[model samples]
Target: MNRTPEDRIVELGLVLPDVVSPAGSFQPSVKSGPYVYTSGQLPIVNGKLVMTGKLGQTVTTQQAAELAAICALNALAAVRAEVRELSRVRRIVKVVGFVTSVPDYSDQPAVVNGAGDLLTEIFGRAGTHARSAIGVVALPRNAPVELELIAEIAD
Candidate 1:
């Protein structure tokens, strides 16, 4: 039997949270033609940020990585809200992650792997995509990590 992406997420002991409401003036996700683009997602759970602080200072790398995963899950939620089904996703085209870190921190790639790895685990080969992990001085809400995704969907 074949499993859907949502099933795979459940198998991994992960549940997609409700889509985080936009903090400013943008939609959480927008579908254009055959693609869906998600706004940057933070690790907010139940209306509160899971963690806040710089990656190399008040937050540990491991914690930041987990937060990155949470951000990815939130991104997925936004996609689902727009597309209405995970099965519509044909390919995860791209991922961009941002990590708020102290000046000495340079392990942004490793931190973002948490999101990349989870997407691959859920969607298998379709999850493979180009990605960028960037470290910055700060992020909105002082979040440790943020993530956004672009996915190709079937009409």
Candidate 2:
């Protein structure tokens, strides 16, 4: 909570993208009290999906990891839009990452780490938080990963 999140973003060379409108009825994020909850974010870079396939089948773990990072970035973008100030974040509360994978694949944690690690690099310890890396039967648009986040904001 020492170094500001804006400074952290700069340290990590990350700039939040504009929060894209939800493809459906849901909002990108909702703020309650000092916390912001972001909707699940798909890995869309430059407004295009990088790849699409179930992990351990047509997709490699490395690619899935990268996709997860993009999801995290998207989640942050939503947070910025919802709260109007990334620097107001005191710390990341938690992350829920979902992966589309083959039945035999059990590397969901590593894939989600792509997002978790980026948070650490960007916010240092303030980014550290509880998390769940889940493997699901499938994801929307067959994305390799989807990420959602909860963050605590400063008054």
Output the number of the TM-score-best candidate: 1
lDDT per residue for candidate 2 within 1-155, as digits (tens), equals 56666677777776677786788999999999989999999998777777888999998888888888889889998988877777777899999999999999999999999999988887778899999999999988888899999999888
Tell me the whole-model lDDT of each prediction, alpha carbons only: 0.93, 0.88
Model 1, span 1-155: residue lDDT tens: 88999999898998888989898999999999999999999999999999889988899888888998999899999999988889999999999999998888999999999999989999999999999999998899999999999999988
Looking at model 1, which ten-residue stretch has the lowest summed lDDT?
Answer: 55-64
Q: Which residue pairs clash within candidate 2?
A: none
Q: Please estimate how well model 1 matches the true structure, expressed as its whole-model Cα lDDT.
A: 0.93
Q: Model 2: residues >4 Å from true position, as ranges?
A: 1-3
Query: Lowest-scoring 10 consecutive residues by lDDT in candidate 2?
Result: 1-10
Name the regions of candidate 1 deviating beyond 4 angstroms.
none
